[model samples]
Target: MSVSDFLAFTKKNKNISPKIRLYLIDKDKHYFINAGTLKNGFSPKLTIANNRDSVLSAFSKMAFLFDELIRLRIVGHSNESDSSELLYLLNLVPINRKIRTFLDWKVFGPEFTRDMSRLFEVRNDTVHCISLDEVTYHPKSKVSLSSMSGFKKFRTDFQKAWKTLLEIYVTEQEKLDFKKLSMG
Candidate 1:
């Protein structure tokens, strides 16, 4: 869509209000932007966008959020650096197929992964034009403003998935901390 459309969608999310700030930058003749916010009461400025990046910036921000959560040990993981892989490295699952089968969806759960996968699929449809129908109809679809509705749906789903992940991480961390303190 347009920058205004992105801003409007972000504005509707109350959680993002106090938590995030979006900035648009011109990098190498292309418009890039980054989303920044306070992390754990400390502002850790992050690059949420890149050159010519559009909707991918939003997806990247979601991934970064999960990465930060995992880094903080708010989410359970066998390793720390796997945060980025968990969010973006889809093929890593096949490389280490056992890790894929072992992912405790009972702990991390499946809802976030499923929603994120859908978001990635929609993004791929927008970017790669692998769908012949999308290649032929997208411009006209945008003219009719139907694409904006789909964009809104994608944005909503992404936000929901991010928020759900955050909640799960925070709750799990709290439980772990409580148990540790009780045992101590």
Candidate 2:
């Protein structure tokens, strides 16, 4: 099916959570996934807080999306080039090193994995602390606004980076025809 058709189908499923819905819609048109309908009684509540629970939840969601992309074959994995190590390189840099094992190297690359790791670091900083010392309001004017604190900056940056990465994944997907793959 076409990408738009897949997105339309996804939107029609009433069981999907609003957050996942927003995430799918916000993604670039190319990287859309046919997630199918959720089973009954599935509900995810995202509680906003400055705690490990909140951070972990967000990270988990991000990781899930990355895995889904790999499953869709939108990206390719890195080859070990050496079977002795049994090591696989990822197509995307991961926010956590642990995700490398989630898929074969042919689906996720090392560069992508590194970028993901950086994104996770930024996300973590945003979710855990608040400080007045790190943000500057006016870049050209060199006028620092006391009102914009570190937490505020982190939140803003995190959202932008998250959305951008989603878009990048989608755009990459558009270039490949998953139907050609035996698994797809």
Clashes per prediction? 0, 22
TM-scores for every candidate against the unseen true structure: 0.41, 0.42
lDDT of 2 by residue, 99-137 (tens): 454324434456545545554664455455463233233
Candidate 1's residue-wise lDDT over 20-96, tens digit each? Answer: 22222111111212233212221122232212254556555555444444433433322334534554554233312
Error of 2 at 91 (Å): 15
Per-residue lDDT value at 1 in model 2:
49
After superposition, the stretches of candidate 1 with alpha carbons farther than 4 Å from their true spots are: 1-54, 72-105, 123-146, 175-184
Q: What C-alpha lDDT does candidate 2 achieve relative to the native structure?
A: 0.42
Residue 142 shift from truth in candidate 2, angstroms: 19
- Indicate the worst ten consecutive residues by lDDT in candidate 2: 78-87
**What Cα-based lDDT does every candidate model obtain?**
0.38, 0.42
